[model samples]
Target: MNLVKRLKICVFTFALLFIGTAVNAQITNDITHEEAFTALLAAKKNAEDSNVLVNIAVVDAGANLKAFIRMDESYLGSIDVAIKKAKTARYFNMDTGKLGELTQPGGIIYNIELTNNGMVSFPGGLPIKNKDGKIIGAIGVSGGTIEQDRAIATVGAKSILE
Candidate 1:
C-alpha cells in the first residue's frame, strides 16, 4: 500500500475509536460499589437509630440492583419491596411517595404502577443524586412504617454526597 493511503487509514481508524469511546461515555454514568456500600451503611445506621428493622436496597441508574441489606428481624416480605422501591425511584427519577400520590385513584397517574411490572409507589424510595445533580442511583427501605422507611431511605440517598 502507498504511504499516504496507509496514513489515511490510520487516521480513520483513530477517529472511529475516539468516536466510539465518546458515545459510550455519554451513554451511562453508573454508581460505584463503594458509593452504594456507603449509602447502605448509612441506611442501616438510620434504621438502628430509629429502632426499626428494615430491608434496604440500592439500584443503579439503570434500575439494576447494586446493594441490599436486610436487618436482623426485618420482615421477610420486605425483601422484594425494598428492591422494587429502589427500582421505582431510579426509573422515575423521583421519590416513590410522590409517585404514589400521583398514582392514587383519580390522580394524573392513576394505575401507573401497573405499567412498570408492579412498582412500589409508596414512601421509602429516593433517588441518589451526584454533586452535579445527576441521578446516579436510588435507595429504598422497607419493613417499617412508611414514615420511618422514608426517613431511612433519605439518609441513605444523602450519604452518597457526604
Candidate 2:
C-alpha cells in the first residue's frame, strides 16, 4: 500500500508540473522586426518638433537589441547608452521613471547600476507590451532631457498600437 501511494503521488506531481509549464509557455510575447522599425520611426518623427537629435533603441524582452535609430549629427556617442537603457527597461518591465526610484541615491537599483551591460537607469526607457499585456520589448531614447527622452519613448512604444 505504501508503494502504491508513492506512485500515485509521483504521477500527480508530474501532471501538475506539466500543466504549470504549459500555462507559462503562453505568457511570453514576441515582437516582430516590422513592429520594432515602426516604433523607431514614430519616435524619430515625434522628436522632429523638438529639433533635438536623439538616439532610440528597441530591445527584446531578453534585453537584446531588435532595432535602433540615430538622428543625423546626433552625439553619436550616446548610442550604447541608449541601447543599455532600453535593455534595462525591457528586463525590468517598467518605465525608467520607476527605475530611477529604485536606482536613486539609496535605492535597490543603485548598487547594481551596471547590472544591465552598463545601462544607465535614467528616465528615457519604457517597456513595450502587446494587446495581451505581455511585455514584448522595450524602447529607449537619449540625447535630450530626461523628460524629453521619456516622451519620445512613450510615443515610440505607443506607435505600435493597432
Candidate 3:
C-alpha cells in the first residue's frame, strides 16, 4: 500500500483502540472475593480497636452478600441487620444513615425503607466505590452503638480504595 493509505489505516486503528479502552474503563466490575475479604478485615480491625464485637457484611455490585464475619461475642441478632444494611446501601447507592434521613416523617421519601424486602435505614451501612468513583459494593456493620457501627462501616468501605 501507498504511504498515505498506510498512514490513514494506522490512524484509524489507533482511534479504534483508544475508543475501546475508554469504553472498557467506563465498565464497572463487581467486587472480587479478595477485595471483600480486605474490607472485612479492615472493618474487623476497626471493631477491635473500638473494643466492640460486631457483625460485618459485604455485598457486591448486585447487592448480593459477598462476604460476612461475625466477631466473637457479637450480637446474634445483628447478623440479619448487617446484611440488610449492606443491601440497603447498595439498593439506594447511599449510606443507610443518609437514607434514614430522607425517610424520616415529612421527608421526600418517607417510608422508603418499607420496600426492598425491608431495609435498615439507620447507620452502619456504606457503599464501596472504586478509584474511578464507581460503586463496586457495600459494607454494613452492627453490634455497637450507631456511631461506632458507622465509623467501622466507613472504614471498611474506604479500604477498597487502598
**Where does candidate 2 stray beyond 4 Å?**
1-28
User: Model 3, range 13-87, lDDT digits (tens) per residue?
Assistant: 999999999888643578989999999999999999989999999999989999999999899999999999999
Off by over 4 Å in 1: 1-28
Output the TM-score of candidate 2: 0.79
**Model 1: clashing residue pairs?**
none
Q: Clash totals for all models, in order?
A: 0, 0, 0
The stretch of ten residues in a row with the least summed lDDT in candidate 2 is 111-120
Candidate 1 at 43: error in angstroms? 0.5
Better of 1 and 3 by lDDT: 3
lDDT score of residue 149 within candidate 1: 96
- Write model 2 residue lDDT over 1-162, tens digit each, in one string: 699999999999999999999888653577788989989999999889878789999997777889988889877777987897798887778887787788877786575666645767788999998777888999999998889999988999998986
Candidate 1 at 78: error in angstroms?
Answer: 0.4
2, model 2: CA deviation in Å? Answer: 44
Residue 157's C-alpha lDDT in candidate 3? 91
Best by lDDT: 3
Cα lDDT, all candidates: 0.93, 0.85, 0.94
Better of 2 and 3 by TM-score: 3
Over 4 Å off in model 3, which ranges? 1-28
Candidate 3: give the clashing pairs.
none
**Per-model TM values vs. the true structure:** 0.84, 0.79, 0.82
